[model samples]
Structures are given as C-alpha cells and as structure tokens.
Target chain A: MPTYLTQHQNRFLEELLDWLRIPSVSADPKFHGDVLRAADFIKDRLLEAGATLVELCPTAGNPIVYGEYMAGPDRPTVLVYGHYDVQPADPYELWTSPPFEPVIKNEKIYARGACDDKGQVYMHVKALEMMLRDGGLGAPCNIKFMFEGEEEIGSDNLGIFVKANKEKLQADVILISDTGILANDVPSIEVGLRGLSYHEVEVTGPNRDLHSGLYGGAVMNPINALCDMISSLHDENRHITIPGFYDNVADLGPAERAELAQAPFSAEAFTQSIGLPAAVGEAGYTTPERTSIRPTLDVNGIWGGYTGEGAKTVIASKAYAKISMR
Target chain B: MPTYLTQHQNRFLEELLDWLRIPSVSADPKFHGDVLRAADFIKDRLLEAGATLVELCPTAGNPIVYGEYMAGPDRPTVLVYGHYDVQPADPYELWTSPPFEPVIKNEKIYARGACDDKGQVYMHVKALEMMLRDGGLGAPCNIKFMFEGEEEIGSDNLGIFVKANKEKLQADVILISDTGILANDVPSIEVGLRGLSYHEVEVTGPNRDLHSGLYGGAVMNPINALCDMISSLHDENRHITIPGFYDNVADLGPAERAELAQAPFSAEAFTQSIGLPAAVGEAGYTTPERTSIRPTLDVNGIWGGYTGEGAKTVIASKAYAKISMR
Candidate 1:
C-alpha cells in the first residue's frame, strides 16, 4: 500500500469513530441535541476536506448537511445521496456494548451506525479529501453531497428540501451505497430497492388491566386480538392476505424468473448462517426474489401486559405492534 | 347496622390499609423481605384477633400463615383457603396511585390485591375478630384459616404443606370466599371455578440481535415467528387448534345448557363493560360457559425487541409469551 493511502485510511476510520460516538438517533426527541451536533460535524468535516459552498440546510426536521466540489463545466457531475442520522439504539439490553461506543470485534466494527450511512457516507467525504490532497490522482468530475438527517424516520423533511432546491442537485447520475451486499467476494449491485411503509396498530379491550381469571373468554384480550389480526395478514401459503394487497404486485414472466433464478444460493448454508432450521417465504419465489422482487411484511416489535418475572394472569387493556412492509 | 359493627368497620379498614402498605410482590425475588413481612403481619393479626392457635408454617416457598379457633371436634369444622401474597403490580403507570399505598377514590378502595383474596381474606380475619368481640354472633362452628403466600404464583409450596398436614387440616367442609358478588342488591355464587394451566414460551431465532435492514428477509425474526405461531394457535371459528385439545371435554346436555342459560346476562352490557365491540369464543358456548365451564387460552403477556421511544429496526433474537389455559 502507498504510505499516504495507509495514513489516509487510518485517519478516515478515526474520524468516522469520532462521528459514530455522537448517537445521532433522529427518531427520538431525547437525542435532539446529538442530531444537531452530527450535522455540524459533517459540515465542519466537509469544509476541512476543501469542499466549497458547504452549508447546513435546515428543514422542518433535522438539518441537512450539504457540500459541493466543482472540477469544471465539461466534467460529469455525480450527486451522492446519504444520511447523517441513524436508527434508535433500543432494546439496549440486547446490545453487547453501549451503542455509541464503537468497538471492533471479530474483524467487524460493532456500533449502531457502523456500516450504515455514517460509515458509508463518511468514506465519500474521505475520498473527496484524497482527491484534493493528492494532486496527481485528481478528480475529473464535479460532485455534490446531500446528507439528510431524517432518513431513519421516514425522511419526513427530505421531500420538501429536494423540491425547494432542485437546481443545486443536478447531476448525470445519483450514487448511493446505503444497501447491503451479499458478501465481500460477490460484487452484486442492487438495481432496485424496496420502498417502506411502516405502521403501528393498537388493540384495546378493557378500560384497565383486569384479572384474567375473572374476565377470560368474556371479552377480547388485546394481546390475543393483536396476534389474531397479525396472523390473518398472512395466509397458510405464507402469502399476504390484506385484500388487494398484491393487486399491483409486478408479475414477472417465467423467462424473467428463470433468468433471475440463475443466481446461486444454497438453502442449508443460508439458514445455517442465521442458525435457523429453515426459511419460509412466498411459495413460488427464490430467497433473493422474495426479498427484492416481492414485498414482505414483518413485525419489528410487540409488547403488552405483565411481561416481567413470573406471571400476573392479566388481560392487558392494550397491545401494540410496530409493522414494516418492504 | 348494629352499633358495635358500624364502629369496628372504620378500624377494620384502617388495619387492612396498613397491611396493604407492605409491598408483598411474591413473584420477584427483590420483594422477599416484604413477603416475609406479610406472613408475619398475618400471624400477628391472627394472634391479636384472639385465635387460639397461630403459627407461620414454613415450606419450600413463602410461609403459610395458619390460625384456628376450635369450638371442639364435635361441631362442624370449617377450613378457609386464602392467600396473603399478591401479584406483582407491574405496568405501574396504569395505577392511579402507588399500588402498595392503598387509596380510596370514587367510593372504591383501589389497590393491588384489594379485591383478589387479600381484601377477602382480611375480612375473614375481621370476622373472626367480630365473633370474639361480640361473643353472641358465632360460637356454633370450628373455624380454621389457612393463608398461603404463593397463590399469585403457582401455589408451589401449598401442595406439600397440605399433604404433610392432612391430619391437622381435617375439617367437615372447605369454605372459600375468594370471588366477588354482582351488586349490593343482587346475590350471586360461583359453584365451580375454572382451572388454570400457565405456560411460558421463548422463541429463539438468531444468536443475537441484528440490524433488520441488513438481515431482515434473510434470517428468521423471532418477533415475526412468535406472531406467526401465536396467530396459528386459533382457527377460523376461534377454536384452539392444539391437537386433541377438546378431546374428553364433557358435552353439556341440552337440559344442563338450559339451566345454565337461566343465569341472567345481557351480552350488550357484558361487552360494553369491557369496551369491546363484541365478545368472541367457541361458536356454540355462551360467555359464562366459555369463561367458567369451557376452557380457553389467552396471552397474559408478550414482549420482544425495540418497544421503546423510536424505531430500532432490529430482528430480535428472542421473543416471549405468557399463555394461560382456563
């Protein structure tokens, strides 16, 4: 490796580790200050990396970190899309370490935003730095970086920002490294990404938690009702049964399916990697197609009643589920 | 009301409130001292209430508070079954006041275990006091009060205690007042009680929590799996689908069904009281029959990942449910 390249790599990781320590969880109001600090950090880094026209674009939600670099008018323009915010670090007991405290274990960096946009987005800024630092391998292209801070929470402010600033984002093609790859060796590129529609349902029964022994079978239990409703979302064949849920689902012909099926996947190795006896999805599609071509519904979280030490035989008034569809 | 009877009611409520102040949550180990104090309270109260024999019966679990007022073996011996320990007051936010600090609001004495056996059992202790104080109200029967501390849990130690002390517990009949009445003007009685079989199931998928965006559709999510499994527990008609679940279930004769139907109940009032649109159970059974005679299953509690302020998008490793069969 070149001496400057090695030094740049070390500095790049160090800077990212510093950024990762901010805990910029956008969804929670408790981390409001931290989210703002993350935007400031990105803006300062972009300025230090010799980017011109760096600014914090405030929206209805968290501010967007914007920067630009111009090679020449004839150069191809590349617009990069990424986020400075991250998902909330919840179920904190499940995490091995404090989520904001980055740790490297088993040749992998373990943190809430590691390998996410924080890690991916920071690399591009570092690359821009390299082009400015090393004069020989200089950039021959104009680049624009738009890092939003509300992507984790449905990108609530991004649509307005994009519409209001259309001319500033003009480019030949947009670049994004937010999606995950299959493996280090398999150089797979995602041609399309699934859109997300998230929802939460609250099932209620009694006005207050009642003794189950006194009220069982007399009224609906919110937990049982929630479970029944969730179960009905999918049929016996593992197909979603939301009544016209699949009305507009694209139907690929057999020829197209066969072409997609050419991708290699072993069921045993796949399930083994996740410690599952088997994997089940739509009856007729491959695993890759089930995830990519087909939309899927999953329950991200569920809770109700006395989920504590032993048991309380309570018919809780409310049960909740956080559902995500992709 | 009689003069002395009306006067004693005030002090009686005060003493019960004092006893309720001890946080005797039996399910949690942290409340071990409180449980013991509850047992001691009962023993001291029994002695003060003029019981001839009072003792703390030690067992594998929390101790049993025993007291007797024998009017000789010739008279009818009535044994009372009750419990001193209370269920863990969880979801404490639902409470209008701290659970251990008994409160009276809107003509209702509200507290954990205020109605479920604790209040009922304490009334009996007061009844014994009344008999001793009045001397003319009850001298015809021999009474034995047996209060165990693990009834909120499985009553694990009661079986051993009962079996070992069979000779000492010899009585003509068992009288239990662990249930409630309809109203001050109405008289009601429960002929039989539903049996309970509580179970806890833990579903494990991956060895650790993973970012849902990375491994969502690839690996099994325990929350999704749990919802799937719980949803499958019932069928189209809301019948429990466990194999041979209804086997050996006694079929109630038409005459018996008619007799049961004679119990006055308005379906509208039942559902409205609990804030449910409708009541649901087996197709043929009535609400009373489903709750008391026929068996039913319900999830007392359920918990999994990321049930917090914002989204974690975690495919949790473990999911849990506390189910009870009645």
Candidate 2:
C-alpha cells in the first residue's frame, strides 16, 4: 500500500491538475460543453482504475458518472457520492494564480477544487486502485462510484435518481468525502450536519432609482431602510430577533458542551488566521458551538441601490440581499 | 406656488442631472476625492439656494454637509436628514445608459441614484429654493438641512454626528425625504420605518478549497454546507427557523392589516413590474403586509467557491453570504 501510494502521488497530482483545468461549473448554463468534457474525463479515469460498467447517466441538468466493481456477494457494499461540477469562481482578480492552472505551493495543491471534494474523492479512487494493484481487488468492500455533475447547483435531480435506482445504489453506509476537518492540524469526524434555508429579499421603494437630493426626505431609501431593518434583527446581546425562531432549537447539555469546548481553540490564533479584529457570534455560546451545534444567520451577499466603481447619488429603486441559515 | 413649481421644473431637473453625474459613492475608499468634490458641489448649490452657515463637517469615513435658515425664533423647526452618498454601481452592463448620464425616458429620470435619496432629497432643496424665492421661507418653519455623504456605507459616522450634535440637530419633527411613494401616480407617505440587522458569515471546511472527486465523501463542502445551512433558515412554510428570533415582533391588529391591504395592489401587476415568475413571500400575508409590516429575512448576496467566467470544479474552502432582516 505504501509503495503504491508513493509511486502514484506525483502522477495523481498531475492528473488531478489536468482535471482542474477544465471549467466544469454546473451552476451556469454556459459551461454545458465543459461539463460534458468533464464527464468524459471522469469516465476515462474510472476505466483506468480497472472499473467495469462505467457510464454517464443523463439527467435534467448535468450527467452522472456511475461505475461498479463487485468482488462477490459476501463483500460489504460501499457507495461513493461525489460531483465533478464546481462552483463558479468569481471576483477572479482575488486569485493569486489562475484558478484553473493548478499549482503546487507550500506542499499544497492550489486550484479551485484542489482540497474540496475533488481531492478527497480522488483519494478513494486511488485507494481502490491500490487495492487492484496489490491483488486485493477481492477486498472486503464491493465499491460503487456515483459521481454527479450538479451538486454545486443543488442536487436537483439526485434525490430522484437515488429513489429510482435504489437497488443499484444499495449500500451499508453512504460514505461521502465532501466535508472538512475541524482544523488544519486536527482531524475530526463531522457526525452531525446542519440544514439550510436560502432566500432573496427584494425591497422596492420608488418605481426606479431616484436622486437622493430630491427624494431624501420624502421617500424611503431602500438601502437605508434595508440597513435599518437588518440592524434590528439582533439586539445588543447578539441574539436573533425573529419571533419564535428558537422554538425547536435542541439545547446541548453542559457535559456535551464542555467536551466540545475542550477542542483546542485559541481566539488570538483564530483571529490572526482570519485577519479580523476579534471573533463574534451568539453571546452565550462558544465559537465552536456557534458554528457547529447552534444555528446561525448571516448575510451572504447584499446589493440594492448602487455598488459600483464610483458613486451615483441616486437612491436605488430596489435593494437586494441574500441570506442563509443553518 | 404653482407658478414657482412650473418655472423651476425643467431647470431643477437639469441641475439634478448634473449633480447625479458626479460619482460620490462613499462606501469605497477610492471615491474619497470624488466625495470631497461632491461636497463642494452641494455647498455651491446650498449657497445658491440662499442657505446661510453652510459648511462641510468631516468625519472618519465621509463628510457631512450642514446648513441652516433661521426664518424666525417662534416658528416650528424642521430638520432634514439626507445623504449625498450613493451605492457602488456594479454589473454596469445591466444599465441601459451610462449610470452617470441621467436619462429621462417617459418622464422618468433613469440613473443610479435617480429615485433614491438623491432625487428625493433634491426635491426638498428645490422646495426650499421655491420657498425662499416666493418669500415662503419665512412662512412657518425654521428648516435645517443635514446631509451626510456616508449613508450608503451604513451611516457609520452620521450616527456619531447625530449623537454629538443632538442640540444643533433639534427639531419638532425630523422630515427626511429618503423614502418613496407607494404608487407611481398616488403620493403616499411612510409613517413607520423598519429596523434591520446585516451580517456576513464565513464557513470554512478544509484549510483550503478541495477537489470534489477526492474529497466529496470524506469532507464537507462549505458551499454545500452553507446551502444546507441556508436552506434550514426557513421551513416548508417559508417561516424563519431561528430560535427566539420573533420574540419582539409587534403584530398589527386585523383592522390595521386590512387597511394596509387596501392599498392599490395586484398580483399580476406586481409580477409584471419586476419580470418575475410570480410574487412570493410569507404564505399568510398580502404583498404589502409582507413588505411593510411583517419582518422578513432575505439573502442579499451570496458567493462561494468559484463563480467566474468559466467553470472550476472546486468545493470552496469558504463560502460567504450577506443577510438583511426587518
């Protein structure tokens, strides 16, 4: 296993870099061809890994890559879920290097999908390859790989596919490698996952963007009204002010809370890492609890009136914001 | 009054166009010089409008323009609050004409800040001029104009200025023309204002972005996790799920709600106005109630992973979102 791991590390990195170069964002329709090309790339890689019955399953949005490797009926069956699609890389100027030009810097592969599910999903493929080379193809697990191309957009069709192909995707436990460690140095398992609600709010004031000087005193500035509305969501204590929001919140006991707090956390270190003044969250909870156990609300993106290069004194006719909760 | 209104209508419109041409966005630091230039423009305009004691008050972020006209000691005082700042105009391609070049089509001025506080606020300035020219300035009120240049950036310094100059800014009723009319033809006044809370959230999974293929099953995609988290904010009924969020929401009586619903509204008309599939909001309330009386949560903006011109199949290490509440 060690020999195989060492022998293929460089080649695996090179192949992954090539894969990263293809723009396969499924969220956007303009990348339809790129997504198809990515599907082909994954199909080829699965075949190279000694997999049989590899095919691209067509869906409403993007294609799903499926393959099977059955050792015997007695073996434990494992189903792997992944996506070849990625999120759109925007604010492109923020990138230190071209996002697609995967680079190896400071022992880390720098690319858009380097450390995300791509790197982790590839690890399992490599593990399967290692088993094949070492004459362990008849290992304990009968592995099945199911890679989709639209998880980034919201696996709109995945649930339907799973329901329809229950027998094909049957497994003891669905093993997914799309999460992260608790920290860079500490390896931890994510036992619980939070749910989400995404929404866009449009606050329309006037019929169109108006001049602030002419309408400042008579009309509502949606941006100002938006800011005022947002400011009132939390009180001085940092608690969300929506009515009945906490009715179903399951509280954590002191013991569990204490154990979670024992995880090594340094405020100074965390602040330095993020380049922030200080960490902020719900007042009564620790940072870990605020992020992991307790639910949180945040503004993901906001724009209404004017968010441009210079300034226009016109009041925006409408202000918009995107919010998320967990 | 009609004569004065008619005489200055075209001139007022032209002058405002010139003012809108100056980009005075205060949120961005690069607009520092432009902001100063805008302040000078306001000062010259105020002088022309017969304002005495007009000066620009400097703050940490943007400058504030203050002016006063003391008609008499016994008259009622009206303090006007406004902002000369505008939002950043981005996605510039979306504009039909240059955001700075104010265009009047179908009797409506189109520009970035045309209908926002700039246009709204300018009406008061024009009204003040009309009052002074028609010898109506000494009619019944002592008007004080307080225009700040940082309203677009959260009014960070204006709050401090307001707190510091409480005595100087005293008035019986603070008349701000920053809101808009309920309908295009019917003039409406905003009697109540909504409060707000805005926040940005960052979710980190791995130390860096990962490839979905290798890491899909083993690790968490911040983008996916963020989506999941966001999806949980509202329930199947679209009500927010945050605990204790609605503790302070003041519910209006049925009569008040009914009266508000009487405002001219049509589902089809509203839908056609914004070019949306349909008008959507909290299930139980009318559109007017949802926008005005009821507190709401929305995702103002959202971004995570790669959102660029091309696709990059990366699970982002971090995902960000902005949320607004009322």
Candidate 3:
C-alpha cells in the first residue's frame, strides 16, 4: 500500500513477537512481573509512536497503559481499547508449539495471544507510527489508547479505573478490536455479543447418605432429583420451560433472520468438526440463529454421591450443578 | 426360657462379645489374620459343644467352620448356616465405642458384627451345648453347622466351596440365622427378598469439552442429555418407563395387601427419621409397599465435568450415572 508499511512489515511483526514473549498472564500470580513488563512495552511503543502523553495508570489489579495524541482542538476524538494480557496457557501439552513463543507458519502466527488483543493492539500502534513517521498524511483526528492488562482475568479493576478516569476517556467514538470477522472474504462485523450469567444450583434429598438397598424405594435420591429438575428446564420441543425466560428476549424480523442465515455455515462440517452426530437446539431456530439470537441454559457441571472406581450403592444426601445462561 | 439358658445367659453374652472383638473384616485384606482368628473361634466353640465331626473347610478365601452332631439316623437332619466375617468399620469416629472393643451399654452389646452372624451362630452353639451337656431331652435330631468367614465381601469363595462340598452340606432342611426379626415384641418373618440389577449409563455429546459461549445452544450438552434421559426413565406417576419392566411383576391380591398394611408404621416418624419433607415413591402404594413389594429404579450416583470448588462453564464430552433397579 504505502512505502513505509511495505518497508517496515517485517519490523512490525518482530516487534509484535517481542511483546508476545513477555507472557503477561494475569490469571496466574507468578506472571506478576511479566504482566507489568508487558504494560511497559505498550508504554514505550506509544511514546515511540509520537504520543504526547503516555502513562501507566496503576489499578487494584494490573496497570492500564493510557496514551493520547491531540491532532487539533476541533478534531473528533477516537478511543482505541484493547488488552495486553492473555489467558493462562493451561493443559500446556496440547499445544503443537510453545504458547508464549510466537511462531509464524503458513502466513499465520501461532501463539496464545497472537490474534486475541495483543496482535490487534500492536496493529493500531504500528498504524499510528506509520502515519506519523512516513512524512505523509498524519492522523486526521485526536487519538486515545487505553490498554489494560486484566481483560483475560474479569477486568475487575478496569471497571474502577474507567469510572475514576471518565473525563480522560471521553471520546466521540470507541473502537474495540477484541472480536473476530466471520470469514476473510465475508469481512463481517458483529453488531452485538451475548452477556453471561452463571449460577450454582443444589438439591437436597436426605440429611445423610443412605444405603441404596435399604432406602432406595422409600427415600428420594438427590442425583435423581437434580436430574429431574434439570430435565424440566427444557421442554420436549427443546424450548426452555422457565416461566418468562423468553418474555424480554427480542425476536428478529423475517428480513433480519434471513440476513443472518446468509452467513457462511455448513451443518455437516460443523458437526464433523466437533465430532457430534448432529447439531440440536430450540425447535424453531437455525444453527446460526440458535447460537446468536436465542438465549440458552446449559448445565456446565453436575455431581453427587459415588463417582470414583467400582460400584457403590448409595443414595447421596445432596447433588449440585453449575448452570450458565447466554 | 429353659433352666440351662436362664443360668448361662450372662456367660453366653460374654462369649459372643469375645468373638465380636476379633474384628474379622473380610472386605479389607489388612484384617486377614483377624478374620482367620474369628473362624478359629467358631471352630473351637463348635468342638466344645460336643460335635462328633468338626473340620475347617478351607477355600480360596477364608475358611468355613463346619461342625456336626449325629443324634440319630431316624431323626431328620438339620443344617444351620451363619457367617463370622463382618463389614469394614470405617468413619470409625461415628461409633459410640471402638468397633473392635465390645461394650455392654444399656443392656445391649455394641460392637461390629455383634448381632450380624457371630451372635446368632453362637446361640446355636450354646443351644447344642445346653441340650447335650445338661442331660435334658438331649439332641432331638442330627445337626450340622456351616459358619463362613467371607460374608461381608462378595462371598466369591463361598460359591466354589458350596459347589465342591455338596455332599458334606447335604441335609433334610436348612435354617439360616443371618436375617433379623422385625421387632423384639412384634417378631416377623420375611418370606421373600428382592433381587438387584445395577447399570452404569453414559451419554456422549462431542469428542471434547466445549466452551459454553462458543457453542452453547448450537450443540447438545452431555450433562443435559444425560439428565433428560434419566428423567425420562420415570413417568409422572413414578412408574418405570422401561419396556416390559413390570411384565412379570406379580400383583398381590387385596387380602395380601391388607395383611401387609397391618404392620406398625407411622408416615410422620418415617419422614422424620431420615429428615425428609415427606416420603415419596410410586403413587397408589403405601410406604411399606414401595420399600418392599414394589420394584424401584434409582440413580445411585451421577457425575460429569468440573465438580470442584467453583464454577467452570464447560459442556463436558461425557456424562455418567450409576442406576440400580430392585
């Protein structure tokens, strides 16, 4: 496109890889120093990009790298938000290559936070540098960068920081590059994302565990009771049976539904990819609509009584399940 | 009621308590010597009772203490059966006194296996002693005693022993003293006992666990599917839904049902005993009927996914339940 970007493409990637090697995993306390160092990496890059004000704002958890460049008083402000931290690379053996060691293969970067937010955040930093240093058309509007180090962990401190620095973050528009495109060719933009609510449910049958042979028919089994309760949450048609569960859920019109259905999808391929026999959901929705438009209640975990080795005939006193709605 | 029994009652109790202190737990291999010692106790007591033939019948597991007294050929031969081995005493802190150290409290002996079989088998030994040593009425018929040492376990060796010693175990009639009387005042006999069939059921959804946000409603969750399948096993009336489940179940007549209803029972007491809101079972059946006559299907245990301390939003690859029908 431009001579500056074409000449510095390899340098931009090398810089991104250097930042990725920091292993800023906020979930683990062992990466505390690395998380702070990653924040510093963002601070230096922002300063090098000719930002006038760059500060590593300290929060209860991790630091938030805030940087700003004012093109003019009349120009509209654009706030670019992203994160520097990545989720914990657990079950480490599952990866083909080391997670923190970023490597490129087949024109794709393989790393834990390569495409999540670190790579996207680096793109904005490099774009600002290209426009400022290329001796060409510079930034047309005021630019603000707010990169936090706790997005992978729940962003608990980010909420407090945003509230405390509301004036500093004021902008005409906000652009978050945290999500993904539908496909390379499609270049889709997600209009909305679902919110999450998690709950832990428990069922109590008897005060104490009892021998199944002595008390099977006479007393209630907690596991059975829990299963019954979970089953009743969904009706025969797979629609949730909770009263008023769908009362506030908005229904998409025919045109909107038809437009969503046009997104690239293959039912057979989807099922084959996940190693499932078929895709199943609510009665009246397509696969795409079921995942995007409709709310779903699912049991994330369930347990009671003897689940170890060999058989043990017991009617457990209590049963529990972790439920989540999206 | 006899003079001999009245005079030797205290001694008989003391002898039984001594045998109970052996801690013959067959389920645990750590008690191997104790189990063998308990078998020797039965053998010595049988010999002291003036048995004409006594032998320790060795099997793959613990030995069987066999003893016999031939009163007369014309008289009917009777074989008495019992066991010396007891179930493991675990969570031992729950016991009022040490399980191995027998104690007499409030006129009742407290010890593992004090009443299970060792107590009852000792009664037969003392009865034979009374009839032969007291010189009153003497032996009315030829008697044989078969006391085993692996009843607490699966009795795997007992099966092989019985098959090999068919001629030695032959008798006109057999009296097993292993069961219990309903109540001290209202003594009752059990004509039949229910059989058990156990099954472990599993439901597989995808090949691997999935993220709830990425694939919530689009794919079937194994835990939800398992819950649905388990819930469907019982209908609204609490009757089993398996085909031909009750095809051969014999229905008792009104007279038999009325006779069974005459047993002393209190619904409030039964519910209070187990700390349940109420006794629940198949409709149209009494509490006793549900426990005794009517067959039942119950989930002994159920488990899947993260059953740990906190919440994990996972659609597990597999869900499992241990089900049993009686």
Per-candidate TM-scores read 0.95, 0.56, 0.73
Tell me the TM-score of model 3: 0.73
lDDT of each: 0.83, 0.69, 0.84
lDDT of 1 by residue, A122-169 (tens): 888878887787553667799999999988878888989999999999
Across residues A1-326, which tens digit of lDDT does each residue of candidate 2 receive? 47777878889888888888887877578878998998888888888887767888888778789988888888889998788877676657668898888888889888876765577777777777777766453446788999988776657788888898899999987788777565789877666755555456667765655444323323444654555565556555556688987778889899999998888866676555544455565678776676677765554445554333333445566765555455
* Cα lDDT for residue B236, candidate 3: 86
Task: State the weakest 10-residue window (summed lDDT) of model 3 chain A.
Answer: A305-314
Per-residue CA lDDT of model 3 for B1-326, tens digit only, reads 98978888888877888899998887677888999999998899989888989999899889999999998889899999899998666546556789989988888888888777788898899989998876557899999999998765556788798889899888998888766444466666666656667778899889877767668999999999999999999998888899999988889999999998998777787788789889888999988888788989888778887665444567888889988788
The TM-scores, chain A only, for the candidates as listed are 0.95, 0.90, 0.80
lDDT of 3 by residue, A173-288 (tens): 99888875654666767788666677789898887777665677887788888999999999977899999999989999999999998888778877897898899999989988
lDDT of 3 at A18: 95
Listed in order, the DockQ scores are 0.66, 0.06, 0.39
- lDDT (tens digit, per residue) of candidate 2 on B29-120: 78778878877777777777777678888887777899887788898889988878777766476678988888989988888678666887
Ranking 2 against 3 by lDDT, winner: 3
In candidate 3, stretches whose alpha carbon ends up further than 4 angstroms from where it belongs are: A1-165, A172-187, B1-165, B171-188
**lDDT of each residue in B125-192, candidate 1, tens digit only:** 87787777654375568989999999888888888999999988989989788875544555778788
